[model samples]
Target: MPVQFIKDPNQVGDAINESNTKPVVIHYWNPLMGEESPFLSLFHDADENLGPNVSLYVVDSGFINPPHDPQELPLTALYVDGKEKQSVPFNVDQVRDLIFSAV
Candidate 1:
């Protein structure tokens, strides 16, 4: 599963809407994430395991639209059926759990 890098909110919305076929796990991050970039590797680790049941979108900060705050550097949003299901802060186990659960 390739992690998508969305630019603006419109792209993000499109990605989330397309997720109607499968759950979407989008991570909104910025350069400030620094060492935390390695933390996101967990998603890649989970990628191949999830197969086609999930879609991963890793968007940069300032591209967050409604329901997501721009000030939040690293926010994770879970979308199902083209709707925002859950949003949370960056966390390793938590995000991995969210993806597995969606699967």
Candidate 2:
């Protein structure tokens, strides 16, 4: 399946819990901005490299009209597996690797 755009935190939690067998990539964003933001682009690129088994959950950051686009501002990527979580600066190659590894 492709990346899923989820707007609610409760839904995100449910989805994550339901998909414990699969790796989940939650693409958080400001709803008002739609997919025009840079984060979406990065997520899209990363999604292209992932296999069907990997799932995505788009969590809305609750910023309807963000002061600045994530693309314009620096962003980071987070990985969560069980209780372990790690975050790092967003990068093309790194994202690619993450997706590939998940698959």
Candidate 3:
């Protein structure tokens, strides 16, 4: 399925809770500096690896400027099932492996 765009923490929480049988990967990135951010590359790379058993959620926090460095915008990978499976610092190849492993 296509990635779902969630706007807040509550929406993320809801998605996590609602997704029971499949793995949910939340992609949080800044949309304001979207084309300029390294996350754009990472996001595309991750999307290419996504499969049917996985659900990808894209969330734009809208906190893209000062006080919130683009780097701080949760570039990590979260595997939310009954509880959070695991969270790690974002790495394109590593994340790709994780997604493939999940499926």
Top model number, TM-score: 1
Clashing pairs in 1: none
Better of 2 and 3 by TM-score: 3
The true-versus-predicted C-alpha distance at residue 61 of model 3, in Å, is 1.0
Whichever of 1 and 3 has more TM-score, that candidate is: 1
Assess candidate 3 and give its lDDT: 0.59
* TM-score-sorted candidate list, best first: 1, 3, 2
Greater-lDDT candidate between 1 and 3: 1
The C-alpha RMSD in Å for every predicted model, in order, reads 1.9, 5.5, 4.8
Off-target runs (Cα >4 Å) in candidate 1 are none
Give the TM-score of each candidate: 0.85, 0.58, 0.64
The predicted structure with the larger TM-score, 1 or 2, is 1
C-alpha-based local distance difference test score of model 2 = 0.52
Across 1-103, the per-residue lDDT of candidate 1 in tens digits comes to: 6877776767887888877888998887775656345546777877878877799888764467576567775777789999988877767777777777777
Tell how far residue 54 is off in model 1, in angstroms. Answer: 0.4
> lDDT (CA) for every model shown?
0.76, 0.52, 0.59
For candidate 2, what is the TM-score?
0.58
Off by over 4 Å in 2: 31-35, 45-49, 63-81
